[model samples]
Target: MSLKVVVVSWGQLTNVVREVQSQLSGEAQIELVEGLFDQQTTLEMARQIEASGQVDVFVSGGGNARMLRHNLQTPVVAVTVSGYDMLKTILQSRTGDETVYFVHFSEIIHELNDLKEVLPFPVNQVALKTPAEGEAFFNELSRQEQPVVIVGASLAWDLARRHGLKAVYVYTPKAVLEALERAVELARVRRQEMEKTQRVQAILDFACDGIIACDQQGIITAFNPAAEMITGISSQGATGRPVGEVVPSLKLEAVISSDRGLFNQLERIKDKEVMVNKVPVIVRGEPRGAVATLHDIVTIQKAEHQIRLKARREGLEAKTTFAEIVGESQIIQQTIAQARQYARSEATILIMGETGTGKELFAQAIHNASQRQGQPFVAINCAAVPENLLESELFGYEEGAFTGARKSGKLGLFELAHGGTMFLDEIGDISQAIQIKLLRFLQQKEIMRVGGQYTIPVDVRVIAATNRDLLAAVREGTFRADLYYRLNVLPLHLPPLRERKEDIPVLLRDMLFKANRALARYAPVIAREILLHLPAYSWPGNVRELQNIAERIMALALTANLSEHQVQELIGMVLQQGAYEETVKIKAGDLSLRAGERKDDLKKEIGNLEKEVILEALRQTRGNKTRAAALLGVSRSTLWRKLREDIS
Candidate 1:
């Protein structure tokens, strides 16, 4: 891209343009115009040159340069008079008593003064503050009696020559080269600025977010394509109009007045809900204007929903089904049939069963059989999380809702299970406050997030499960009656292992196969004699407990055998461990204390009872941490940590 340069000069100084052309880098193309020195005429000629084509820069001398700079859109570079030019002109002139007059612009008077000390002759200097002042000074000099010799700018020298006086033009080739160099640099900077503006405009047009910028007076200066779509106002109409008139909902004037930023403020523009963030554009500590970015609220919500759906398709899904429920007992079959029927309905279901009785399994099976089986099957244990954190775990929260919150917030289990089933395990263990919130969601099908102000509608089918007697909890005032009734709309009572002992053999065989695969063991069979004794014994921990015991027995032997002693010893160990745990429970619940027993004494007694149970389990397992942890339904780390705390 060649820089287009226009030079305005006198006919005598036409050689200056040739010299500038020689000094120019090949990046510039120069055109010269001579004898047009008047301000009005120079401005017209500059405009004509621009209209002819592109004019990146303009170069001229003194008065013509100043006029072109003020009147032309293209940048104008003025040829400056150097101190050396003034010194040379003074040295060639007349001496003292024969006065030499120097008429120049006021800004260059300091350069002329520096040359005064070097001159052997005294000279008179006249300073022209304005173009008008210079013209008047020239007229006064033309009427003088004595003929004067003058050295100054082109305009002053031309006026002196018209009045029949001798005049010397103070133009140097070095000054013209400097002006041309400056003009080239100015053109480069302007070109870069224009390119940057074009890039920013392209980004604003392509962005999904609507963008708008306003001057300090609230007149809209910019409106992007998205802004037009969101606000229903075209850029042609919005720009140059007051922002308040274009989009009255946005309080841009208020933002400018306060010199502050507002984020994620919901407003209605043209009947569309938008979340807008308005910020004052500050420059050098002063509020210059303001800018706003808007997002359609509905669009944002849909995008969030799509993200969750994609995540669900990638990993979160239910693997359980009715076929996975391994049981042949009448009660188990009846329970499965009732669950299948409930799966056809969208009502909330309450599954009542003891811990480890496969309540979650039933919930998953129900989801897998339902119409929304292909969607997410999210679950959360209400009892596992602390009360303070449970609400966020269930309903999620907005960004910056609390300390250490995720910057973009998080989706809760309920939100993740949209259009599907959400299994709220240990539902009865939730706090009364959370119960009220849950009941509200059950009734309204809407939930407000933790530390949020708006309600979000969810289409999730809730299935709550708990071992606690919700009716008893409701009667005791510990649980909300409304919530209990809401959850108990479809009640399911799962029979305990003791009541369904006929399913033990089948359950044990299936558990053994799974344990074999998981533990990398070759145990593929259990003795019939061992299976016969399992039905007579009460399986306190239900199917899960029976599965654990199957693993224990398989650890003893892999082949089928009729060994009553081995089965008897394993059963005795389990029964003894159950007895010890039962003693701790009974003692801990014992309200009637002996006379003179302090509360501290009762706590100590309970702690000692628990320690004794743990010790007996350790003894039965022969100090094996894994076996002892499984026997107590706890982890090995928990057992070790408990021992450390208790021993200390």
Candidate 2:
């Protein structure tokens, strides 16, 4: 028993359908089904055909198959007049360069439009409202020296030829017939390709491991669903963003340069040790990209150990210390100094800055500089963990505390940070309940785990950082006032890059040097003009923005020397093109007062101001020109010459 294929009539290609069926008669069983030109009748025919469950493949011309495909489970094959068919038909009907007209049905206008795009000669297409109208239009077009192309089926072709105008019949040519056969073959191949792609995507999506792919340039091309689940970043958010910007652990350039695949069971990122496997994807004997898969090794190990303990129990390894901190800004240095002083005395330190400004660096610096350097430095991002999971994460949980809870127990962040520092990032984002728990911990130096009765005493120093204004939050009743005062004991605000313009040159040089070593490229020279522009522009993303720009500059500078002017030009283009969300706009006057206007106008204004100042100074000095010159911070001879010139 063979699969039954159905062929439906459409347009004027009913004969063509029968011809194809005859050709395939011995190869397969094909059932020919005919329907009216009307859409509803065609759709009803498809529904009846589908109900029979006898059709295995649906074939028709123009929209017949398209309409049937929507209502039927069978494969659809649509045949239409090819471009070559329309072109050849028009050229053959023309005598010399004399104008020839072709008439087409209104339904096939789109095919005619496509023909116009690919055709060499200028062709005019007129749709037939009625056979008479089409004949009249064809006669009018026949008067021109050029040819008009009409695209339709056999019946329409005969109607135009009857009008005594040169008429060409449009249908699929031999080449097009072969092309359709190839297309069907290609569709089978494409289906296989789609299946393979979907399988790979599903494996990447559902796997517990995080997967990330980067191009040869080290820019992230793909981040899988599991990657998003682990990293708390969505594929939509991570795509096109640099790997360094997203994961901060990928070390994209190093991975690219090594060429050799890396498989390490103890790689650390975001404070979790994980097994990482990096493989280079090579095409045509050249490296194209790299794929990395990572899973939390410690969590996996602990889970494995738990399973074994039931047969055996297991183990761990962690701070805010200055030695652990990394930054070289004067603002950071001053912040560290203040944090150190407060750290030894048990004063709550409030480290304030924009997100990613290294508030945790300051917290660590304070912890390291203090007497509690030997203790654990537990850091938590208040905004990262969900509210439901936040309490368990902060305070720990007893066995069987909730569904899917570990059989044994979990140590809260406070317990883990006992005898050291707890750096809370985005502290202002914490809810009132968490704030209450935090305040109690600060007041009593004790924490009660979820579903646990006894309070565990812990000696931990709290250092909190927030991009938000805690004072404002407090006034708005969103944040507790008591917690604000407690945390605000030693306030240190890290100024944004724009404010500390003096630090940019030093920062840029240092960043470039570090990047050079990491990226294995020569550090480009920093132009003074670029430095000047850095200060004028406001850095909404602050130090992080500067870091990213530096990386971008390094990447762009690989093939060319990046001058200060080039840097400014790039910044201007990005601003003009709306690449940067917030940018400072400098007018022509701001660039230079003489810019975009006549120099004479500026000189006149300068001259008037200069004369007024000189006269006033001379009058005040009682015409003792030497005194006026001293007051004006100029030489006595210069003032005398100016006075003489004015008098003359």
lDDT of 2 by residue, 579-625 (tens): 33222333122324434455657755544545665787677788888
lDDT of 1 by residue, 347-437 (tens): 9999998756799999999999999989888887787688999999889998999999987687777888888888898887788899889
TM-score of 2: 0.40
> Candidate 2, which ten residues in sequence have the lowest lDDT sum?
309-318
User: Which 10 residues in a row give candidate 1 its minimum summed lDDT?
Assistant: 518-527
Runs with alpha carbons beyond 4 Å of true place in candidate 1: 1-309, 312-314, 517-536, 554-629, 633-648
Give the runs in model 2 whose Cα sits over 4 Å from its true position: 1-333, 517-527, 559-582, 586-648
What global local distance difference test value does model 1 have?
0.77
Best by TM-score: 1
Clashes of each: 0, 11
lDDT of each: 0.77, 0.66
